[model samples]
Target: MREVRNKWVFKKVKVDVFRVVRRVEELMRELNDDMSVAGEQEVCSEGGGRWLRPEVGWVKLNVDAGVKEGWGLGIGAVCRDSEGAMLWGMTEHRCATLEPSMAEAEAILVYMNKARRRGCSRIVVESDCKVLIDALQLKTKGRSDFYLLLDDIYSICNDFEIVL
Candidate 1:
């Protein structure tokens, strides 16, 4: 990571007509820094999950995992600062059935990507699923379909620190 004047600088490129995802990540990091430095209103916080605060202004992202037998799956995430204020959040519902681990992973990916777009950099993600956390920690390979999702997650990881 290249740091210029205490700000991370990233090259932005346009692919065809659409922009790559990392640009959003960079902007999100900037937004988070500005909000924290300016002491903006609270957006969200770690409700009741494990979190690791490695930096003074780093944001905490809390995600919850839910599974439905026939209906599919649902995941919710709330991004907050150390002050316990909400910054941004999302609740995703996937119609396709998925394993608990996959659901958890997808949820984190979703939340992380969203946070990146919002300019969040120093982030600690909190989730309720221990299995998912362990898998991410162990860096295990998943199924083929899951592999693609994991790839996206891995690509964005360069933008933020993920906490289990």
Candidate 2:
């Protein structure tokens, strides 16, 4: 019985690892593509406190993640130019139960991937989740389980100028 259980766990782990590898490959391909996706990438100049614009030639991407008990996670990103005008925006819903920090980090990775896919030149990313920011900035060790996401974020950052 114990052996059977171990085999089942191993199978699950293998499948999860495969999915992650496939995802990383997909992101790499997206980054290499030069064509930008057509649509709204920015927003108006109104924002609450804590919103700041990046320098000229650099766009600021603000991302947030929210999770509702029993409901799943929602993540979004908005890009603003030096004039505080939005250039584009995106939102995503993920169905998974992970730690808040992990969820936030995942959301950030999602948006970073999007920006890379769009062939952004330079970007400053803003996030309210300190844990994710700290991890991205290498200020904290972060949870080991989600280190893959951090690694992916770092790799994505290499494709262009990124400020966290």
Candidate 3:
């Protein structure tokens, strides 16, 4: 029969290997959890909030009017990391002629155009302006002065991703 000490040493070696394997397994499980979370990108806005989940990775923008009615349009956009924390936030008032609908559209156009310039290829545009959203979605024709400005805003969609 094999010496008792030899048998005890062999058992110890097997136990050590098993412990190492278990540790590796635990580490791998944690790594998987982190990776899945890191893969997501979230964007929250006034209308609602959006998340990339997995397949979708995009910048999201939200626009709203400012306190001053005739001062111009106030636009707010925030870019977020995978964890729903804002990476960047911007709010601006444009120096354009003011009509509520046109101002809203212009704000969105500025936000989208800025995102495009920053090399954002995928984006989700959000606005509280239902009329503008409807107009863009409907692809309406003809023009009033307001419509002409809206048309210019619509034209901006061609340059980048706009989620209305």
Q: Of models 1 and 2, which has the larger lDDT?
A: 2
Q: Model-by-model lDDT, in order?
A: 0.68, 0.70, 0.60
TM-score winner: 2
Candidate 3: lDDT over CA atoms?
0.60
Candidate 3 TM-score, true structure as reference: 0.59
Give per-residue lDDT, candidate 2, residue 128: 85
Error of 2 at 78 (Å): 0.5
Error of 1 at 74 (Å): 1.0
lDDT of 3 by residue, 1-164 (tens): 12332453455333354765577467545534654666544333223544342124665565555434444445667554334434455777565557677667767777677777778766666666888888878877666876786777778778765566
Q: How many backbone clashes does candidate 2 have?
A: 6
Evaluate residue 20 in candidate 1 and report its C-alpha lDDT on the 0 to 100 scale.
31
Worst 10 residues of 1 by lDDT: 1-10
For residues 31-118, what per-residue lDDT tens digits would candidate 1 score against the true structure? 5665567564533222332234335688888787677677678788978777554677677778978888778888989889889999
**Top model number, lDDT:** 2
Model 2 TM? 0.67
